[model samples]
Target: MATWPNAAIATLMETCGEAVSNAAWNAILNIVFPCPTYLVAPEQRLDSSRPDLTVYIVGENGVFFPFEGKPAKFSWEKLGGEVLGYCIAARPDAFQGYNYGMGGNGPECIICEYDGANMRYLYIHEGELCQSDKMHVLHIFRDAAEILNVLEFVRGAHV
Candidate 1:
């Protein structure tokens, strides 16, 4: 539940000191938190290539949420293959992308155990359901809340 003027989001893009993808993620996180927040990259290996940043959302009891940032792309199936790597990481569970208007259906997230073998899955609902341009800012919040809800569900179930 954070609000940033459209101008601010543009300003963030204009003055980014990191990769476009990472900068987008950082800007969103900045809006989410009041103080300076730094995302810790997950510590795990995936098919030789991983995302630009892996953010950690650790609950009070040590449950970790791996938030991986991905650029919006056209290929959903291909992206799914790449996302499999995140599910394979050495972490409790994982979530990818910041809900930037990358509207077309693609791999949204991978939440799994850190055992290095067992993997569970959660697919973010496509943004197509919401009527608008695929990359609009408002849609980001709507989808992000859904992602967070799923994460909380997984946490509550003790999965």
Candidate 2:
């Protein structure tokens, strides 16, 4: 049976009538992650760069998730660099989580890259930008159900 992520992707393709674009992905994310307390903004500027989507968890010390979406043909290395730059420039605190001799709290940010057919989740910890071993590739066609569960878990929601 098709899972939630696959179902969502199918619905998006039907709605878009073409390969899903960054804007379409942002809209789909809003639907999947609906909330009155969280804000999902598309095409938001981060320093001199613009991320495809920026999700802000509302409240004191709100968190931000920077997402980059591209066509399936795009190169992930190039896209990852761009997203990394945005994260570094707009949310440097995310990279300081494991800094030496630091005691103050640093923001934890998850950098997401989606290329229509696949999704990759990355993070900056201990001065290294690394992909989660558990969630390196979330293939829309092959791993849709797991993708939905992983996303919820990443967002700290019970699955």
Candidate 3:
């Protein structure tokens, strides 16, 4: 794992882009994950077409949550494919828990399981079914104390 001592919001903007959504993710992550975070930009080109980001904590815990920060409409079938892409590109090996799910080729969303983490892509559907696609990232906590610590961090940040 690469060490990022200068894991600041400015560094993330330099590496990622100047977008509110990216910034939101960074802020949220900085609050959620106590570990210093950094944005992993794609090589050679500089554009926000694809977002590559990863957060690292001490020891053998890391998570790659690459997201296409945009808004779009999708049907259940299209959403399933997109969710598959997100989960497949997540690189679960970086996290402690690693599991994923596929909706058995059904018209629903393809479920992805990471370790003990589970999320439904159909969360962004509509009305009673509308839900945001599962956000991919590491939410690591060794114990209740750590969870409280994270909560405090978020509360302090007011994110």
The clash number for model 3 is: 18
Q: How many clashing residue pairs, candidate 2?
A: 0
What is the TM-score of each predicted model, taking all chains together?
0.42, 0.57, 0.35
Off by over 4 Å in 3: 1-18, 37-52, 58-62, 71-83, 94-119, 122-159
**Candidate 2, residues 1-159: lDDT per residue as tens digits?**
212334556445444532364544455356555677567776677677666677666662423556666654445456555655554544434223310000000111124533233335644435444454333444443444444444444455311
Top candidate by lDDT: 2
Q: Sort every candidate by TM-score, greatest first.
A: 2, 1, 3
Q: Summarize candidate 3's per-residue lDDT along 1-159 as a digit string, tens digits.
A: 322122343233334433532444444445445554443332112132233233433354333443333221224455445445555554455444442322211111122333333453322122232223453221111122332342343223221
lDDT of each: 0.38, 0.45, 0.34
Error of 3 at 13 (Å): 16
**By lDDT: ranked, best first:** 2, 1, 3
User: What is candidate 1's lDDT per residue for 1-159, written digit by digit as tens?
Assistant: 565334444344334433553555544444442333323343333346545444444442321333444444435454444444544542433323212211112222333332343333443456322222122222233356654444444444333
True-structure RMSD, every candidate: 8.6, 10.4, 12.7
